[model samples]
Target: MQSFRTELENPIVERDIIELEQKIRLFREGKIPDEKFRSLRLARGVYGQRQPGVQMVRIKLPYGKMTLAQWKRISDISDEFSTGNLHLTTRQDIQVHFVSLDRTPELWSQLEQDDITIREACGNTVRNITASDAAGIDPDEPFDVTPYADAAFRYFLRNPICQDMGRKFKMSFSSSDKDTAFAYMHDVGVIPKIQLIDGKEVRGFKVMIAGGLGAQPQLAKVAFEFLPADQLIPYIESVLRVFDRHGERSSRHKARMKFLVQKIGMEAFEELVKEEFTAVKNKVVPIDADAWIATEPSETPGALPAYTIENPQQFEQWKKTNVFEQKQAGFFGAYVRVLLGNISSDISRLLIEKLQPVIADDVRVTVNQGLLLKFIRGEHLAYVYSQLEAVGLAAPGFNSVADITACPGTDTCNLGISSSTGIAVALEQVIQEEYPGLIYNTDIKIKISGCMNSCGQHGMANIGFHGSSMKSKGKVLPALQVLLGGGTMGNGAGRVADKVLKVPSKRGPDVLRSVLNDYATNLQEGELFNDYYDRRGERYFYDLLKPLADLTTLQDEDFIDWGQANDFATAIGVGECAGVVIDLIATLLYEAEEKLLLATESITAGAYADAIYHAYSCFVQSAKALLLDDGVSCNTQISIINDFEKHFEETRRFPVSNFKDMVLEINKQEPSAAFAEQYFQQAKEFYKASQQYRANKTAQTVNA
Candidate 1:
């Protein structure tokens, strides 16, 4: 039998590696002149991701969690070797993408001092052990499951069972019910669940195995609902062992564990896994987790200082869209949106420098495709905001209806189907206009990818589009296949998105416009877009898209009006910074339970008329400003509360009307019926707390 070391000295790691090693050996032996090391390093995938003159080698941190020095060494690596643009990937790993390859061995040697290795970063292996992005932060968590996530990562990091698997594997820790780590799309997903012996909460996790999606998607099956968290490592090891031995080897595409799980029934898979777990359970020591993730992050030095904003209207809007509530008190979390996650060399350097001044000594990269600038001083948030804005990084559209995630396509790779970045921009622009008010008050995530590789995670959005090519006028043109009703993390039960139909790259905006238009026309008074699409079924969307999807022509006039022929920026990671105003409004419209909520109400005949009056007044002031700014002034009836009365004789106690009635019912309805009324209300409360968020932005702008 071949030893594991021998198995690695082969060609799968790219043919060039072997050649380079041979050259180095010959150089050492004086067979080849010793002056060739510099040229050799640059050609071996050792250079930086970008930065023409500077080379930053991306040492992969497979899982996001690392030892204190491994974390600090990365900080040191960047400080010592090259520009410090270290990043955390959506795959739940760290990427120091700009480094000098000539310093490669030195980088590894330094990491080795801290016991870190980057060998499994880019090639085929179980890359990272992902977990809830807020694994320890969400207060509503059933348990802090980071320990298990860390355990799995360490147990599998360099295991022979994981290396050179038939296809890449993704395992996740769903510590909370939210499943935001996207466990449903991973090869294995672990979620904490309490087991009761006598009504006592015993520690265990509900293990789901083999859930994945790409060209083919399958949700994991439950293998165990209550296995002790300590048992996780061995159990997962068992599953991987089975897969490594039994997974399909003949076909690369069918080799994923998801297919293997399907090939064998759930019961059989569990039986096999149990046998494997029992075999290895005694070989390892009980891992001590206290040294890893201890608890939720607390406020620390170097964070944005807090300021008291009296009324941050614009900042309120931005916070409502971008900032998220942390489990911590008197402190909040901000998702530093990195505009398609592209960090320029200058910006990368700026990120490290600017953040170091305000954030705590520790900085964390998030898998949400963003950065987590942790531990801000309660009073300095405004200062950080000001600094970020000064750097041309302020955005009002953080998770707005237009906040989009897209995969890098065509320009960088060969498999991309469409310009996902271009489509994302166009979609955002159109929706922001047509549904301005509706979009402002709620959170909707929209993700896109240039191909079915699922890099932008199109399978997780409320509304998502994947790149596809369709024959147009006898020429294949970039197009998209729309996927609807997909969301995870603290939301609904995960659902595999149903593909509607193909929309040409040019006509993508139109298809999106048609859907939103139908939404505006048909939504059940207060329904969010996903529920509306899910309840209506695919037939409704198909019928609505019929006209636009049919207009695919190679002539280019019928598709995208803003582009210069086949080039659209919708490919993954193409860097879509602006141009969002027009595209979104041009897509889908409402058609059912369809009634636009009166931005202002005219109720005056109620006991709570004072409260109703306050609502009415605020609504009117807000609407007048909103509609006027929206360029909707041409529609006179857009303001139904123009004559709102201070008199208490006509309105009901809950003076709002049901916005979901298709008959346009004026019957008094509670605001509780619309858009997860409770959630929207909660978001409003969060926004209200964003008093500091708004003040900080103002202070930021003033300082700038």
Candidate 2:
């Protein structure tokens, strides 16, 4: 570990790893609180798994791009630290399970040798920034969005503004209006656009904000029809500033940015963002598209291997489903459909070693948990196909109905209720064996999650299922909440699937068959799945599949969950998707002091919006601490403000005209230099008074 510390070139990253090591030691020594330690580790990408004493490490891959060397490095790390299996997640990140918590720093240090990162991959920070797998090679793209997505990830990787926010923030970049990256379902979604400005073409983005998916899904609203690409970073920064200050904190369910937009309409959110612009350092930070371009290789393919297809039928099917022609002339893009997003380390190594000659260096991890190999010449397609098939990776379905998306349900997730992976495999088998014709139908997307947090993005699937349970005859059985009529409508628009019915997990295959059979029998020609769903509505499908939901028809096998040996038990562990809450008064005050120091730093940096938000947080933390001392507990930030006004302001214990007005002024005032300084001063004074008041009150109590 010390040797790794010396090898790191970046001083800040070195300090980060060292700090994690120190925190881990403190936590083990019982010096740090469990909740605080959890928060710290989660931010560092060490997640608690269902099994005791093991961690699930999420490796953040910016836009899911990985070179052969980086992939090999991860494979090696997985073999050393975890089971020799790599799991791809819906967020375009890779995860490995059952790792010792103490060894994460060492693993991270090793990954960083290849410029790979795991920081902010989990917890209430900005997760991985994803983009279209076809961003650089998409034919319909106005321009490639890879550099912009890369820039956003780079800017926010260790940025102080979002390090300890109320909840996680998700962002995506779509290559074009087709929205392959599902921009409509992110905190901030951007689609590249070219506008004719004064007889010249100008590159910009169509920006959408505050979209999210969970039990409650909200499609993003358009923030700008065309925001200049140069102003992208500043606009996002201002939005983050507003979210950090005013977003819900105490309630984990409502902590997402979408709820913030819901509480204060989109117009109000926009106004708050406008108020923050004056504080941003660079209003127009231009993006250089050429900074990282996939230029054609100087040394082209030497010779094509003479490969004979073993299964001509399967190879042709593979060509139809998995192969894509890139925007680059004569070059092709190909996909490797990893079943259930699980690839063995040996297979991953084979992909790196065997596919070297035929495939290009540019490899992208697709959102559907598959690998996208770019820049394959037409002549090498057969060779590449043969090599992929040799490695048992040449599955024909790429984002097709046969390719099912699922989370690692009871396999490792703490929050998993039923077997998402097991049911996913069964459903895919049904698609392959029973409804082979639907493989060509890419309109209907099927996604499944272990639980309703939508880690599998079940909320946005045309046909989706999430792990659940039901009671019948005084016995609990694994169940799935069947969702239908949800999918991307393109151009920052989508639908959240309605939970139509619940059935035994074993009946999951029957549900897919019933839905597809109905659609196949009663659909009009050229009509899409969503249109058919809208025409038939939820009740029609409910009636069609209601028989399967009958509890009386349960069999003994239904008691056991998929991929499990024993009868089901609804044992849901605490989900650390949102960082654990910390409410101790001393801890709160310590945090307040730290926040004040951050505020002072932001003010020094001329990041006025950031400074204002930090000051706002400082005030809130101080107020909450004192309020807690007074035995007044509030759930939300806004409620805390109002409660403080009622108890402290009205009682004349706090010297403020109105507490709510003072704290909520973050959204009201422009983030100008003068206002920011004045507001920060008021916050500082308030914090000082709160501390003194608490101290004096404690002294009086002691004296009595």
Candidate 3:
């Protein structure tokens, strides 16, 4: 077998991990080196990085729960292949890394053998479903959230409709009060909150819609009060159906569910979902969890014994910081801080190897993206903590502010928008040096997403940043969109940082400095950034730092250019069906949109084409319902070859139909006075209508 890289050079596994392992194999055989690997991948995917060697593979594990054997398999694989590091991502899956290109396919196959798959783990597809890892384990949970998560994953995975979404779709499942999972950052967040109805407790999820992170971030809107668990799958499918059918597909930047829900208004969107869910209601399946749970392997080698320790101070601190009483009495859950959640190559091996002998055979990862050693007797606490510390895994602050999480940004990701690891390191340093009390007094979490794709979940951070292109003078440059006021959409989830500023990649440190300084100076007592944004709208603080966003914003004293500058020149969007070589489409239908210019340009023609433009726009609006009725498949693209043809026959008066655009090479016989007069008339009328609409909207806003 060929060896992969020796930690000196590596590749990001964003788009997928297959090609990466192939390169590593060839290199180990001395057939290819650095340049070859770069050229091999430079084409098919987005490339970014952290430092240079330690690469991060952000795997998609939607709904967060996996089989016990799957967990053990990954744990063992991490030891044998990677640097023995496993990171539980906020999106509800674990990420392992440091395995060179050589071991990638092996790791993938190992996962595959267990009937687990990871396609689109890194790509633009809907990432892993995120559900509270403690769903079945937490007593406070309304029901086992795993089945709903599982059904959603199966129904949507690789569905055509979800393939080319305007942007990614995120969903979450939580049962407890620990919204620490950042469920609010998702496109859809589901939490079980018991409400009294007729003095009886019923299980239902408070459905949250629209909330997401990227250049623009917004808290989710509550869409439904109580959606029964049985209908959860259908309800979620309906939500995606609305998004898939109505979401904007043109601008890559504006393609998130949050944008769609915001533009249409929550009530209207909910009605649309109800209409769509009605279509798939019969296909829904109810999960019988007890039957499945009965199959779980019996607890390995009996239970761990409880021991009373002599050191009350240390025990008390550990109990306070490490343990929690589970829904099952005397069975407490605790998180083991792995210090930035990093593990060594050797430590990973021993962790899985010795776990059977230590705690009970069963172990589960937490939504906090950390390994959760559950069912540990009080006696095992000392031994586990000691061993974890021996490997530098004992970084204090189990939920303390210092337990900041960061995804691998440009440091090791090919598609990374920023240096996530680097920013995390710097941010932690500043926190430790500047404010020690905040770490203990309040729970502060700083999460960073390298790109808008949300590998790091920066959108839900107490403070967050999405990778962006900071262009000037018509060019591309590195920048980060600061997202704020996103957290768990449920009672347990905390609000993340709201976007207060968009700063250049290099200037992020300084910009954060300014924001922090302001936060410290102006914060209300006991107010976090989330509270500040809540009390005062996001704009109130962002407007304060307008100077940072202005073109005149100067670089800092430590400014230095890094990577290639963004291009601001002309651009083109390339896709299938270029010039339909039917000698190209018979004629161009340039999307048949109703831009203002089109309306004005049409009237210049002799009333014939002018009437057509108005008729076409009306036809489109009328047909909107039918167009979105069929429900596009979630994993593929929808090609409507005859949609335009049918529209053409019905709206025969229009100049263009059937996705066909028109170009008029008019040989004007003198500047026709008739056309000129009619053109101005239309423009004036359009202007008047636009002005009235704007005024009405402004008045409504002011009143609200």
Candidate 4:
């Protein structure tokens, strides 16, 4: 555990790395609780894998855009610190597994050298900000959304207001009305829009809020048909403020922003957001689109060496499915389908070495676990395809039905129940061999997750499966929970997949064959798969696939899971996807003190709004600690505030008078320097008093 302090240039990032090192030391020494350490490390992108004593380091790439150098840097880091493999995630980040926990700080320092980060890649914070991979190059886009997404990412990264929320927040930018980024499934999804204002064109966004995908998926409500671009960050900030204060806390399942909106109507949520507007740091933070430099090729294009095409038909197919003409004239965008989003470091290095001359410096990792190469010259497509083909990266059907999306599942994730990656590989083989023509079909999407948490985005897939299990005749077997009829409806609208049935994992390929065959047989002219499913109904698909679910037809092979050699058994570890519940009073008090320290730091930095929010968190944390000690369940921060008043303030057990109003003053007044100072003092006084009260009670008990 060597220090990374002197190796980093940026003081802030250096401090962050040093803090991680210190925390890791403390955690190993048993000074910090497991749950608290888990939350801290998760926020820094060090995730606990199913395998003991190793971590998965997720490198956050905002909007999935990375320079060739950054890509190479990650590959090198993978070779040095991980398994020499990189796993691209559905949120547009890259993950490397089997890393030693002690080496994380050094690994993170290396990543930051190229301006890459792992911060907020996991845990209860603002995760990666993803956008349409074709954001800048899409012809259908009203305007390029890359800059706006970048601005949002920068504004929220390490921002105090969202540092510790009830759950993670996701934001996306759809380049066009096609909704390629699936805006309807994000916490704050935006689609670029242009409006004529006073005879001039003005940039804006179609805003959608409170949407999420999991076991209980919800489509976002339209917050605004068109909100001016300048107001985007402020509006999002206000929403986060409201969510942090009033969102569910005790129950991890109900902690998302979508649940908050559901618990309180969207209209009321909007009112809460409005109440936070005054407290937000910026009322109208404008995004400077022109300041964002558009990506271009790093080298001059040289004449391609004459090469013979071994398979002209295959090359033609690749062109049709994987290549598209970009909005930039005479240039194109090509997608390289990375199977299961896993690429070896050797192949990655070769990709950079070979494609550097043919493509732009900007490489965008797609949401479907693939890579998007931008600004390819028309004459270079053949060479690019040849290079990709040489490296075994030339796969057709970039985002088509053949391109299946899946999580690591049992391979690494603690929550994985069955083998998602194995089943995905099997399903993809089935699609490529039997349904070759389906490669051109983009309407049908197939996704898989190890569990129903939707890490693989299975909740909104046209045809989806999540890992499960079934017991038959006293033996347990791996199973797949089938879901259908979910897909994007365009313009911040989508439908959640309906759980159809469950079948043995070995029959996963059969499930795909049956569904596609039925779809092909019963297809009407000019009908989408989902529309046809709706026309036929859920019961129709259930009955059609019902025969496969019959346990009596199962064999010994069905008892084993995919990509496994032995008998199947459920071996789920405690999931760290949302961190863990910390009910320990001492831990809560420590966090309160930490928040107060953060408040002082923010005040010194002249961030009054951030200071006020930190102070507010301190107040809530201290109150919740006392309430939990009194055997009160604090489900939400608002509940904690109200209950504290009921149990302590009214009873004169706590010194604070009108605890609710005292804390509620955060929203009632603007975040001025004076108000921020006053809030910090009040929070400091409350924490100290709470600490003294606890000390006295403990002394009395010990004496007795």
Clashes of each: 81, 0, 54, 0
Q: Report the lDDT tens digits of candidate 1 across residue range 1-704.
A: 11111123333342333444555555556654322233234323243232343443545543355533456676677667755555545675555644544455555556555655565553336666676655565677776677777666666654544544445677877757767676667777877777787887677777777888777878777777677766777777777766754565436567778887787777777776665543342334465656764633433554344434443564566566555566667555555666555554455455565556555433444565555555554455665566566565555565556667776444233456667766767876786676666445344667787688677788777678888776654445567888877776342146677788877777777776677677778889788777888789889878878776775335555344233453343333312110111111111011000111211121222212122222322232232232233344311111223312211113432222331221111113222223223323332332233233334545787999
Give me the runs in candidate 1 sitting further than 4 Å from their true place.
1-59, 62-88, 94-117, 198-200, 281-287, 291-312, 431-443, 489-492, 552-554, 557-704
- TM-score for every candidate vs. truth? 0.66, 0.93, 0.64, 0.98
Candidate 1 lDDT at 693 equals 36
RMSD of each: 28.4, 2.8, 16.0, 1.2
Sliding window of 10 residues with minimal summed lDDT for model 2: 295-304
lDDT of 4: 0.92
Pick by TM-score: which candidate is best? 4
- Superposed by TM-score, candidate 3 places the C-alpha of residue 235 at a distance from the truth, in angstroms, of 1.6
Across residues 1-704, which tens digit of lDDT does each residue of candidate 4 receive?
45555477788888898899999999988999998999999999999999999999999999999999999999999999999999999999999999999999999999999999999899999999999999889999999999999999999999988888889999999999999899899999999999999999999999999999988899999999999999999999999989888988888999999999998899899999999887889889887798879886545666766766667888999999999998888889999999999999999999898888888989999999999998888878888888888888888888999999999999999999999999999999998889999889999999999999999989999999999999999989999999999999998889999999999999999999999999889989999999999999999999999999999988999998988999999999998877767799999999999999999999999999989999999998998888888899988888999999999999988788978999999888988999999999999999999999888888898999
Candidate 1, residue 280: lDDT:
46
- Clashing pairs in model 2? none
Judge candidate 3 at residue 673 and give its lDDT.
Answer: 43
Error of 2 at 571 (Å): 1.1
> Candidates 1 and 4: which is better by lDDT?
4
- 2 or 4, which is superior by lDDT? 4
Clashes of 2: 0
User: Which regions of candidate 2 deviate over 4 angstroms?
Assistant: 1-6, 295-298, 303-308, 596-616, 634-692
Supply candidate 4's per-residue lDDT for 691. Answer: 95
Ranking of all predicted structures according to TM-score, beginning with the best and ending with the worst: 4, 2, 1, 3
Q: Report the lDDT tens digits of candidate 2 across residue range 63-135.
A: 9998888899999999999999999888889999999888888999889999998999998899999999988
